[model samples]
Target: MQNNISHKQSNQAPLYLTNFISFPYQSSQQDIPVTQFMALSPFSVKWSSNGTGYKLYANSNPNPIYTGTGTSFDIPQGFKHNTTLMLEASNAAGKLYAFLTIIISKPTLTPDSITVAGTMDNPSILTVQGTLYAKSTLTINGTLNLGNNNSFNDITVGATSNIRGKATLAQLTANAIAGGASITTDANCALTLQPNATVNKLDTTSVTASGSSNIADLTVNGNITANKASITMMGSWNLIKQGSAFGEMTITAGTDGLVLVYIDPDNCDAGTNATAVITYNGQQYSVNGVNLYQVQSNNALKQGYCCVPVQKGTSWQCSGSTSGNGQSPTIYVYWIPFGADKSS
Candidate 1:
């Protein structure tokens, strides 16, 4: 008896693959058959009496990689790198096929000195055991630290940047453009500012401005020892020109009978014939062995005259005919003219 199977009576429409995704990611040895991986065709056949079979053909190959009688078949190895495989399933009623791209390269690391640039999402982390370098700007939103004795070259911290740890560098350029930005050193460490650098404010134990500097305010917490200069208060003295005497005159009785007057050289011209009257009990006396009363007091009141009738560190004492203990007289002070020319 001869049996006939018609396509109209067949249950198979097309090969219904369980997973159409590419097979195993890695390939076995080059051009070698790798039978570990398998593909599945999960469809039912109407003519199961004839028994179903499967075949996998890789990349234009006419021969079947594996022919068997099941819904699944082992993936063939010996496939070239990145080749595609066509899986065919057939029975007495009908036959269908599905295409799957195969991957054949084992995972490998980055080649030496090759740079790869890509974005990392989902909060990924990259850990480097060796040195990492960024030729351009390196902006870290979080903290950055350097272990002890580690040094960085030519680092520039921005205006908003805050350096907390102790950073020791061969050379550093820090520009604090923002307000309230400052460089603070550790309590134990000493902060050294090089020559010609100007700082608005400084709070340290000791600061040595080797070069000229203008500081708004400097608060030193320790002793300030000046090696070469002295700190002086700010002020001066002016020459007060009141009046002048003209000739050999006896000091009359007035307010401050003996007035300690400032003989201004600007007003009292040279060669003026004037002498100081030094009389004790109506007897003429001399000062420092120089007869001032005879020397003509005009020359006595010149500039650089040590004994120009001025008291040292004390107010001038006046003893006139009307002066007495506890009852002093008020003698008027007047500029008597002894020279031909007189000044106010």
Candidate 2:
């Protein structure tokens, strides 16, 4: 009897185990918060008592926390945001005990959600797919799982988020990628990875400026910046500026002034124009219009991008107000082929 009781003691309250996450995400889509995590997925839980083995609440209702024989447990979904993570531990003599309540939460996700914190002794992994708009700070251990085509929309990480193994897109931007990560939505597709003044990761992708178009305010890292007077972008509509501080726009032309078209990576073109949305970037003299001879198209736009220059009259409204961006921008004088895709 004592031996059986001893065995139970070894399997107490919050079990300590490895962890994993599964969310409904993809490489070229938007990211939605996941909601369920099966108990089988391993989790490291500190025991309530100084020793091992205990009871865990599997359901939110009936609230029947179970007493297990081992230190391992299978937690359920819905119960994730409990916040009050409590556990019960026991000893060989059938002594039940409680321990410190730990906080278990991660960035909000879709199908599966779990918080993985990287500690000095126990650093964990954070797998982000598609376009990630981190409203908070994230930490990673050896590596952060960044799939190709994955974009981080305005999220900051620990000093430097790296993968001792093979990290994916530690530094990310853009949307409409080929594939790899499991993201589903294109929210904040114009994602930006804060330039860690100290740690600047290389961007594997390239943004080319051609035709009579040029780019301005698009900073540099180690990434390639293709420039020319002609923009070889994809469609009749092109170039989605930094929606917020969306970098800057340079209009290239053979002559002096012309109209410019700005696409919305967040929304598709609305019939003749794209829908307009406003972010936090300033908008006084920062109007989305053609600056009289911003730059010349035939010239190289390492600092600008342009299209087939047109007469000043072709000035069409893509989706902004002659006043404020009351709407989205259209590829007025240029073809709509340019946009920021999340490339790894």
Candidate 3:
């Protein structure tokens, strides 16, 4: 008897596992990526997967630091430097791997005060948004920007120190200010220069002096408007009056004090033909040497010169006679103020 036994084969679907693993991230964190961690700070990495087993490895180590089925793992301690970690999830089908890079950062220190024994070069930056107080010398080799609406109580610069750019100050006290592009003062403000101060050049639109001011050797390239002016010169001549005929003329002195007047008569006939008499301060003075020049150009025209002392604002009178041709003599006056020239 030929017995043919046929074994029955079981038909079942192959086991397949779906991978729903997510990129590792810090627990309860938002807005920042999970690539950096502060040293000595404990944090947790969260993930999810559909696999039945999950393993986490740090820095590609063969042995896993965590082997569990949980969805999160807490790092024992933060890394000191940059590090890489890997997560592996496995089932009957195959294993799925995920990687992450964690950058380690130094912890922030918020001490009440920091005293550096030597130089600090590692950080190279210190930001102070508020007031900064330095009890000792604060030397800055770089640019110092005092932001808007900020001020410094006092700043003392050394000989070699240089301060550049525009600076606004309420009050500045210095022994000397040198090598500046310009200096400006507000309206109605007074810029006081000491007795020993020397200004190489001053260029401005207007300079008002309510009190007295003395300048030695001032050279002005523009107009000077003043209520009063006192000028002094040595061996210099000033032409006070010109192209004026000697007759019954009145002259008002333009000075503040007593002035000595010299009358120079030109184009006058010879020999007492032209006479000038001046009355000032209730005193009468006559113009002596009435004719000093000889006859010239076929005419008996000559010159006479005389000096008189008169006070300021005194209307001095000049009475003179005409020449032979009934023409008044042309006169030139020179004023020498006694206040300006002390020796006069």
Top-TM-score structure, candidate number? 3
Residue 21 of model 2, lDDT score:
20
Estimate candidate 2's RMSD in Å. Answer: 24.4
lDDT of 2 by residue, 84-117 (tens): 3334445443444333222334423344444545
Worst 10 residues of 3 by lDDT: 1-10
Q: Candidate 1: how large is its RMSD?
A: 22.1
Model 2 worst lDDT run, 10 consecutive residues: 1-10
Please give, for residues 1-344, the per-residue lDDT of candidate 3 as tens digits. 01111222245322222222222235454323455567656656655556568787878578998899876777766665666767776655556666666766874444567788777554445667565665454555454545454333444443333436555443333434445345454544445543344334444344443334444324456775656765443333455444434456676765433333343444444443445566777877655324433556444434466666665566676664434443345555555653354222
Model 1: per-residue Cα lDDT over 1-344, one tens digit each: 11222332346444333333332334333233232232231111111223367676667889976677664443423343455666665655565556655444532223335453754222333444455554443444443444334344435544344444444443344432223434444465444555666667665544555555545555566676778977432122212222233224333322111233322333333333222233434444222111122255443333312112222222322222211122121222333222221221
For every candidate in turn, the CA RMSD to the true structure comes to 22.1, 24.4, 17.8
**Cα TM-score per model:** 0.26, 0.17, 0.29
Q: How many pairs collide in each candidate, listed in order? A: 19, 70, 0
Number of clashes found in candidate 2: 70
Model 3 misplaced stretches (Cα beyond 4 Å): 1-247, 257-268, 291-304, 308-319, 323-330, 336-344
